[model samples]
Target: MTTEEIEKVTERGPAASAGVTRRLGPATGRPSEASVLNVFSHGILVVWALMVGVPLLWVLWSAFKDSNGILTDPWGLPTVLHWENWSNAWNDANMGQYFVNTAIVVGGSVVGTMVLGSMAAYVLARFTFPGNRFIYYLFVAGMSFPVFMLVIPLFFVLRDFPGSSLLATYHGLILVYIAYSLPFTVFFMTAFFRTLPTSVAEAAMIDGASHTRTFFQVMVPMAKPGLISIGIFNFLGQWNQYLLPMVLNQQEDKYVLTQGLAMIALQQGYENDWGALMAGMMIAMLPVLIVYSIFQRQVQSGLTAGALK
Candidate 1:
């Protein structure tokens, strides 16, 4: 292990010396670091996907089982494929009406939030008027406050809105959703708007483009990525809204998907129709799953594209 072995290895030439060195420690050195990391990462991702996916699959299969079947064989697949559970959830439970009400409210709110939020962001990002920072901060303050904290005051405000109360009305719910979504939308789009090049709007202005024209034709088109991102966020939030509708929308006919699901779950009582409940959960989840699957690429791209710019 001393000078004799060292001289013997050196006498064997560089290749043999390298072979001895290799035999002294790990045959493959640190090159497998990335490979190890890759496996580890994939392992983590697989675990995460299974954690999310297994529960969802359980819900989907349980929709096809009756109360007794579900309770008895909780982990097993459906034996009968009880499609009547869907019909019962859709027809008997009035999920159809709830879905329609949800679609209308969410659709209106997403549109309103996008339109108003984008315009406000444009003005705030581009203009240097007095109170611009103050106004931006005012909008941002909405995000800082919890929705629960504001719900009490908001309830009173909506109920006392002029002659007729806005409570339980479609427009009222839509307006409230828009108000809640705006802070995040405006904040996101404002940052995105600032990142956009000013030259396009300036060029449009030089060609005698009006302010409105420039905004609609020039700025809005450029900010489409940001709009898509915020629009999706607004849609998801408004679509799954429960508490707001539960409190404000006290009318039975005006229930959203979340409200309807809760109603079904609560109405289950001692003799619970777990199958129908599972079926209703799937019905509510379907739209969101479809939407996320469809626009996932756009969602990922639109949200991050501006940052790279």
Candidate 2:
């Protein structure tokens, strides 16, 4: 064989030996193995995306549907947009009032818990104090306990306060929510804070920043992902909380959305208003979904930051 033919044959040896003896047409480029793997991988991801998206889409569609539509075609699109359902839900169910009450409770709880939990986490993560591990474990223990177990004790403790019971009051619910949420928030923030470079704190200290100033101005900003994630979590928990609000807030005006929804449902035993019920649920869910969508990036980043580090 000529030298030129030998060189061409040597270049094709691996492809022929691997049983991949395929010739590309002049116009058609050869597909890489990487491209094939990516196609298969993207196919899996598309399936997963559909699995997650379909349910949310169904819920949104069903919110515009009436009872017969729900029964007959739960997955089908709405015949007519039921925008009035939202208005009715807001008015008839007193969801506007519930929204205000929920705002107060959720806002108060989120602020207090984040502030306290972040501070606690900062101290535990940065300083060498005695029993620090014990304190962290204590908070973790609180996380382990069932929320229901604390309700009875919390009820009496608030009940025995100076003039009136904390039960049925927004402040009481706020306090309870803060307490319940603090443990996990602290845990998350501590892990996140630990992941931060200590040099930032040291540099701030060198510049004559007090611990308080350094924390509020520098460290907290660095920990934004963790705080926002906890805020979203606490908001969802407080928003969806039924048993606590039901047991505590018996007054009509004081009812949070979840408890109000339950009462509406209970009343519907006589006359089931499925459209209204779905509307009420959609109304209750909208804020959480919006908040999640808004801060989803931060939440995901915070969740993975520990492992990433």
Best by lDDT, which number?
1
User: Looking at candidate 1, what is the lDDT of residue 261?
Assistant: 90
lDDT of 2 by residue, 218-244 (tens): 999998867877777777777788888
Estimate the overall C-alpha local distance difference test score of candidate 1: 0.87
Per-candidate local distance difference test: 0.87, 0.80
User: What TM-score against the true fold does each predicted structure earn?
Assistant: 0.84, 0.76
| Candidate 1 wrongly placed segments (more than 4 Å) | 1-45, 298-309
RMSD of each: 10.9, 10.1
Please write out the lDDT profile of model 1 over residues 100-204, one tens digit for every residue.
Answer: 999999988899999999999999999999999999999988878988988999999999999889999999999999999888888888999999999989999
Q: Please give the lDDT score at residue 70 for candidate 2.
A: 69
TM-score of 2: 0.76
Query: How does model 1 score by TM-score?
Result: 0.84
